[model samples]
Target chain A: MRTEKIETDVLIIGGGTAGCYAALTLASEAGGKRILIAEKANIRRSGCLAAGVNALNAYIIKGRTPQDYVEYAKKDAENIVREDLLLTMSEGLNRVTARLEELGLVILKNENGEYAARGNRNIKINGENIKPLLADAVRKCDNVQILNHVNMTDLLLADGRVCGAVGFHVDDSTVYEIHAGAVLCATGGAAGLYRPNNPGFSRHKMWYPPFNTGAGYAMGIQAGAEMTTFEMRFIALRCKDTIAPTGTIAQGVGAKQVNVFGQNYEKNYGITTSQRVYGTVEENRAGRGPCYLHTEGITGEQDKELLKAYLNMAPSQTLKWIEEEKNPSQKDVEIEGTEPYIVGGHTASGYWIDRERRTTLPGLYAAGDVAGGCPQKYVTGALVEGELAAKAIQKDLKESGADQGRYFAGQTAGNQAAAAIRGIYSHHLKKEPGPYSIDQVEEAMQKVMDQYAGGIGSGYRYNEKQLDLADEKITLLQKLAMDLKAEDMDDLLHIYEIKERLIVCRSLIAHLKARKETRWHSFGEHSDYPGKNKKYEKFVNSVLKDGRIQIIYRTLQKGDIEI
Target chain B: MSIRINKEKCVACGKCREVCPGNLIKIGVDKKAQIRHPKECWGCTSCVKECSVNAIEFFLGADIGGAGSWMLTKEEGDIRHWIIHKSDGSVKTIQINKKNSNQY
Candidate 1:
């Protein structure tokens, strides 16, 4: 059979924030050299920052010193953050921003025209358009070529190390292989493992890009890369079953969190509102559920008031409130308290790497939201990590004599990865009538996540029973994934991505199970945790081996780390 | 005055909440519109007519966008539309209501 094969110096997957940044940075380093980006979608629309991101988690803009910011983060995650990681992050912020600025991307600037502060210490970012613009930069570079509308099915392993990937073109089911010196997996995060549509179904159900099914994460795990922080999902307390930020109202309005008892919840919990991270989580655990941040308690009111600076800025929460309180669904769901808006913190999952973006696996590197650093899930963090990984690759390439690595094969891969994808493409193309189509499997997955498994209303209370149910449904999805057929190009991408979601979902379940005490989120209600675990102040990270999950906690022997 | 929503057409994009004169309007489980801060809502159809899903029902009186977010004295029929002012100078907000209820 006629097959397609391509080769490059660097092969990056997923066209979202990390992939785009990796492409751009690689181009800068390998000027006139070749690079390929295998994006399931075109350059302008990547999964990472598709709907815009929440904020720049790592950009310490004006007032906050990297050292001070690091100290604050350490205390917030209950003093479990790795000190070295925090320092690397703090130090790397400016150079990353300057790189973007040099790329024609404009970050909000200060009065002196330097990169402006989103918070006192962080840069105010425009999440909505940053990914596309980054894609544009990648496109403009002559050194990089984006193989769009292609779904990556497997990694090309040279002696158990990632050398490249074999993917199929979504349009006509054409198979292609890319052999590279280094393969950077930036396939964004896995979403679409489940969807939430309680009684008041979403007026819009497409909360996430349908394609971010965690292809990269699956590839890494399958490749034997160690995954971390899989359980500490970047969960959001979604409002009215829809994905909206209560943080917008809480952190924005400085609304004091009063429990149903109307007591001073924050004070009752011994929390000082100045600490933004833990304070909210603790309040929720104390039955403060959904509450307005009181101006008297915290300066969070600035978040709301500051939004007025935007053009015609209106609060997104009001509509969410109307639906939750007024919708006609039989199941009465209120998102005020323990509900979380769970989105994959892609970069949040990888092994604890240094500023150089090195994964524990030599020659394996991670960037974007898929790479882990405490606050590494934002657009800026992903951007910075991507550049750093590329620079590391540059150094490695210079030191090594591995010219045997990275080749462009005009013929597509003929192995398991390529064959696994070919079956799906043919199934969809042939329009096979089966037990489930790709969409059906996806819908099934979403229902399971939203209804039972600590989705919204999960005051950290995912009973072992419900977790089993989620697990059963997850197995069904995996079963369906194997037999499922596709209907179109999008369906083909969706099906394969669903497999990726299963990996993320399985990891998250294990993570949830491992954490005996709910730190940020309460157990079931997601609204309440009785008391602090005082569990050793340590980091909770996860890794996969031989298809099994492992959990680790890193804390100072004292349960709090020494600065 | 309360602006009720036509639940059938609403898509729960939450665009109304972003523009609500009052800090009201939220997305419920079904992804439909919900009233959050009823006291906060100005009873302005900014949400009612502003709703692209057409989920919002206009109340008797709410300063439709462009009418009073700024001192806008346009044609009553033109008032059906929303206009936003940009100080650094840009035109934002699209007035969806082409027919003027004020004239009627």
Candidate 2:
């Protein structure tokens, strides 16, 4: 295997939505600084925006203020959010949306030439090429270099400060040792950790991108960075088999959530996001086997609008509709809650960062879905976080002065970290076939999580006994993961993806046990504690210390506090 | 449903192989793109969109409302033309201009 060394002023991992924007911001503002983006796939179609989206879901429409957006997010999360992060993120939503428009994105405009508002906090857009546009803009920057098809395994740290990261090329055997003065992780969030809605051949058909395996969360957990709210997972309420976004049909045609009996049961539960999913589960349990978005009486024009909207974002849903020859006007779309996912963009579940997007570890920053405490940070919100982190990195690097000399001096440490990862790769390559294949191990992990950790199979509810069993089974899986062998580079990538998912699973189980209340309904339903407890209102944080997850509770940060 | 690559139309540009998120597509010894694992494909159509020559076609299985229909793409400048071939011998086309995608 070949080894390559790289040095950059700022290293941005996972060149998806946030990573691309962060690089664009740094390249423009931090003049002459070297910026490198290492992505698992090509940046033009990476992260959550790979297929594209139909609307900007976090904008402050007319008559709505940034503070109002903050309040909406706070109420949705049940007062367990970082108001500072939400406020800062909310304040930049329109700015970033406007920036995207300037970059050639097509935002739908009304007859008055203003942006066509979808709802109180969203505007429609034709964003199928959003990722490509961002990638194109970043490619124009002279100092930015993108490493496509590189899978980052671990972050390089010295004296508890991040110096760089280590990974290998997916198609080849080249190991990359990158040493940067500062690093920003925008790797998105974890999917496929729990059992998915579809099985076998169709397993990858889910709400979030199936490729996002929680690498950022895994690396940070291994490096002992504090994480928050793994228990408050994000369970998307989507179209039944296609798993497409229901927002288009709901907001576009003003469809109401109705059970099979044609009765509206949405308001019976609360109107919060979690409550919606929880209500569906309850309806099904109460003999209403199938719940749906009532679109029976919509006009043909509205049906065409729904089809066009989904085609711009999720083509599979549009294709399904076309194949069935039944439009929304004739058939109501069946809805179901997908498997729980650990995503900070939709729900707070990632690194505990301050307002400037700095994690507890120095020189290590996080943004986008990987940065916790800012929920409901849809596409525009992620762009805002990326900008915020880039600005912070510029200021911090300036204050610390040019540290190339010190960074180079840390080569010894970098070598040691690289050697450790190399050892694992070589060990896996040379090992005999174990009892279980990587696929088997991954399926086993998912089964354990589904049955015990509030996954879809268990109606998104878990008790202490189930969690204890989950912890024990997951620990055994981690041990088995170490012994699993890889036959080639492709197998190697699968091994690491499963390993990262396992690590996130361990952290998620601990957080689930630590928070002893059913705070967010089906998101984190604690069967043992069926009701929310005032004592458990604070954030449930954790850090891996001495090979064990240590739980820590932090008081809520309210209002727009200065850093 | 998974994607099937037509070797006759393939130029081996490797665009589809590079853009596949699952890394399921690879160039064979004959220098033609082949899917490594058809069952594992999620049918994202990223590869289909990237294949400029229409070498790749996504199979529309009977499971998700599609009964033996196939889909392909043809990009002409900024316009993307999505063509569908049905089992009943009928064809349907949807043309979308990348620049005016929001006009609807």
Largest TM-score belongs to which candidate? 2
Count the clashes in each prediction. 88, 0
How high is the DockQ of candidate 1? 0.04
TM per candidate = 0.70, 0.98
Q: Best-fitting candidate, measured by DockQ?
A: 2
For all the models shown, what interface RMSD does each have?
15.7, 2.2
Model 1 Cα lDDT, one tens digit per residue, A1-563: 23686767777877777778778877877745677888775666446444344345566755667888667665545454555655665677777777766664535555686754443454544443455567778888988887876778777665566667777776565777677777777766655554443222221222344345577777776666666555555444333333344333443334445544455455644432122324445556666654433334323333223232111112232222222222212222233432232232322345556557666555567776566544533556566667777888777766774434435443233245555645555765675667766656766776677665675434335656677788778877787787766655545555676777776777667665665555543322322333347773455666677667677676543222321
> What's model 1's TM-score?
0.70
Candidate 1's iRMSD: 15.7
Error of 1 at A360 (Å): 4.0
Q: After superposing candidate 1, which stretches have Cα over 4 Å from the reference?
A: A51-57, A105-118, A125-128, A194-211, A237-348, A351-355, A403-432, A450-452, A523-547, A550-563, B1-104
Off by over 4 Å in 2: A403-406, A559-563, B60-63, B101-104
Instruction: Supply candidate 2's per-residue lDDT for B88.
Output: 84
Would you give me the overall lDDT of model 1? Answer: 0.54
- Residues A1-563, candidate 2: write the lDDT tens digits: 78898888999998988899999999998878899999998887888987788888999999899999999999999998999999999999999999999999998888899998877888888888888899899999999999999999899988788999998888898888898899999999999999988865667778888889999999999999999999999999999878889888888888999999999999999889999999999999999959999999899888776776676777778778777778989999999999999999999999999899999889999999999999999999999999999999999999899534346574677678878988898888789999999989999999999999989999999999999999999999999999999888888888999999999999999999999999999999998999999999899999999999999998886764332
Calculate candidate 1's fnat: 0.00
